[model samples]
Target: MAKLTAEIKESLAATKTAYFATAAKDGTPNAVPIGAYKLLDDETILVSDQYFNKTLANIKENPRVALTFWGEKGGYQIKGTVTIHTSGTIFTEDVAWVKSLKATLEPKSAIVMKITGVYTIKPGPDAGKKIL
Candidate 1:
């Protein structure tokens, strides 16, 4: 089974940039650039405010999602289902949660996701995970 590694956590926490992939009802995948996503736990993730777009809507209808992070060396791909949150709650009811999304610039428009699995891609120069 896929597991979250220290390296994966480091990359996700260190880089604030990622591309979220959501699919239309027909199963066509749509990818967009996003900057605010929080790993609430080993399986939960939070975006921000009304920041959800097609991807968000898609996730609401179909919880399946793919979130990714990349750098000069390599990157990790996180795929999971998002449990929709339409309004505020104890977790996202303060500036601290708001402050975490400063990377997004538009902190007010953010959406979070709950990750379920972590996939290693472009593993290394000598070894790599097969993209299947």
Candidate 2:
């Protein structure tokens, strides 16, 4: 697997929140912010607590998900495949790598995303202009 860029990593870690989008079985989409996540590996993401979550249901309905992380410097919009594991052991092996960060995470809540593609979010004032 390829590695995440420093900017991408920083964007995710630097912020306490992230935005994720997932689609229902019918392809209808829903998105919302998650308070926490830890990078399991260069291509994997671990999120704690997957309950009462639209993303979780969407992932159940469709494994594909998109995560968008933003920071003061910039932000990354990541497109990846997700596996929502309700069990605590979901990404156990990866936790050691995130011990310092784990101190600030909510236990018994976890979801992992295997990143596949990424893009940058740069909204400009003129971005809203529609051209057909």
Best by TM-score: 2
Can you write out model 2's per-residue Cα lDDT over 1-132, one digit (the tens) per residue? 336887778878788778878899987999888765778788888766534467667777788887776776667777778766644556464343345555654344456788777765668764323221
**What TM-score would each prediction reach against the true structure?**
0.72, 0.74
Where model 1 places Cα greater than 4 Å from the true spot, the runs are: 1-3, 88-91, 94-96, 99-112, 123-132
lDDT of 1 by residue, 44-131 (tens): 6666543556776677677688887786445778887656544467345423666654534434433556566666666466333433
Q: Which residue runs does candidate 2 get wrong by more than 4 Å?
A: 91-109, 124-132
Give every collision pair in model 1: 45-113, 45-114, 46-112, 46-113, 47-111, 47-112, 48-110, 48-111, 49-110
